[model samples]
Target: MHRGVREFIRWVEAHRDDAEIQLNPPATTSDIAALEQMLGGPIPADLRFVLTRFNGGVLPAGELLPAGIEPGTIGHTVREYAEAVGGDFLDTELLLPFHKTPEGSLLAFDRSAGPVSDTWPVVDYYQDLDEHRLMYRTFDGWCRVCVAEWTSDDFGADFTLETYLRSGQRHAEVEPDVATAHATVAHALKRSGRPADSLAAYLQAARCVPPLPWCDWEALKIAAILDDEASAREAATRLASYAPAARWAQRETSPGRVAEVLGPIVRRSGDPKPLLRLLEQLKAQADEEEGPVVEAILEALHAGKDLPPVRPLREQSVVPHVPDVDAWWEASQAAYAEGRLRDDDLLLDPDMVRLGRLRPFAELLHIRRGF
Candidate 1:
């Protein structure tokens, strides 16, 4: 185990009783086994250890602790309550935990929702809930949490929710340049009401940095609306270069738009080479089984009479072919006797010369061609 993981484990054990409110010692091994079967994987190691320690009893039951109390406030130890919750805590980006009511309702405290009772259950037994509105985390990261409304062997109504802890926080602290650029572009776009010409300019400015999702399409749509053919072409080409999978360029109808927007540029440019190259890339990508936008590119390429040959590339190898095992063995023995073979080389053609059975070069030569 890593040093950090070990230290965290020690801290969790020290505060197990206090940090986990409504604590109860875990059920027997059989019960745990059953829960594991239900969850489809082993419960995380740290979480397993915590449940084992607190399963049978409650510590601070019926009282909600403040945000960050469970993990951040437990102790100064690097691991503490945070580590005890296991990888899931970090993966989910949990800002706070929901308190389950006696009536089996789930509630969370959102300052954005305005003043409500201290206990605010998000879902009530009588009210229908929006599954997409319920946020949850996964082992990979915060994703739409899919909860099954009805359990079947195959499929169920899975719920998705937002990650409460915002993304890009670490980037802001660690990569100030990138964060600043993104913030600047975002602010500009917001203030400008997303004008097409302004968006095109911003796209050029932000091309070297990581993109915000859907930013390219927003720029492209703006360019098209403004009827700036050159700007639209630039936006399309850039979008194709950076993210061919983006939905705007991926639609089957997208090629018509690309050709309409970029056709004039293709005609007027000194050389058709750049346009041809872009067409080839789009065509090659379209041939793949994935991405609808590739198909759109294919349509555009065909429309422009710019499609390139789609034949696969072939390369030649130097190794000669031997017809059968007997011929291969005789050739191999001659090569070994001539000191042309090494242990590694012999291993490469095991059928011709088994590694252990092959004699040393000198002995093999003495026995063979009279060395």
Candidate 2:
């Protein structure tokens, strides 16, 4: 494998935890060969490197690839293609389908050019028309294309801003403060150098998630860049409210944030009395329920060990509140206190979630819509 490709794989591994991209693990060399052999074509060097590393997964390429054609691993993709279009597809030098387009067409590379050129041209093959149309001169070129707008038509591009922006917008509407979806839009706009537009997005993010340190921080920076003194001051004030949420924020979150939240004043006072008082208060709160989790938190505090923090902004989530949400919470808590429930019971409980105070460790659960 090329050193550059290896470096890219390392980057992918580092970022696979990001929620936006659906990255699969790297493919074994033998797995890559099987996929290539299944397609009856030697994969191009750049394309091969990416496929081997990512094994085809949805990337942060906004709008270019529609949600319909989710990138699948080479092995799964080829198997599906074969099952869909029998043995004859292997012989065609017409289109090498890599992505399934939202419009029910196949986005592929024109294999006919592969033999002559070091890099093959990309094409969109419409099976209904039995024709393939050139889209880009090379796979490398397609990979580098930056989508500036959104459209439903087949004007031609691998990534589109439409789907990505729409998804973020939907998430922001639902879980704004919890998940920081608006921040995704803001960050993308920043990267595209649309500072004015990015500032607008950051403002929306600040509104949706007022306590987000990054939103205020980014807004503060962007406002200053735009020379908007009023906006910068407003952002700085909001950032101050979040104070120490961002203090230990590395990338997204860390255990230190929890310590900071619980022990900040106690550590400064130099009084064990206050610390004990705080622990007594927490214990009183925990009196409603006590499991291994609360015990661990108390023990960690006493031993000067780190406790977990609140859910990371990007990973925080919430659910719809039915009228019965309160009732369900009460019942679940009682069940837990009585040892009538397991972790799975709380996890599967409709009222219990990572955002709200359902249990002692509710704040630390992975952010998702219902467990």
What is the C-alpha lDDT profile of model 1 across 156-186, one tens digit per residue? 2231111111122222332333422333444
Give the Cα error of residue 271 in candidate 2, in Å: 99
Top candidate, metric lDDT: 2
> What's each prediction's TM-score?
0.30, 0.33
Q: Of the candidates shown, which would achieve the greatest TM-score relative to the real structure?
A: 2
User: Each candidate's lDDT (Cα)?
Assistant: 0.36, 0.48
Question: Candidate 2, clashing residue pairs?
Answer: 62-160, 63-159, 63-160, 63-161, 64-158, 64-159, 64-160, 65-159
Q: What are the runs in model 2 whose C-alpha is more than 4 Å off? A: 1-15, 62-87, 92-94, 102-104, 114-117, 127-130, 146-371
RMSD of each: 24.0, 21.9
Reference-based TM-score, model 2: 0.33
Q: lDDT score, residue 282, model 2? A: 36
Looking at model 1, residue 182 earns an lDDT score of 39
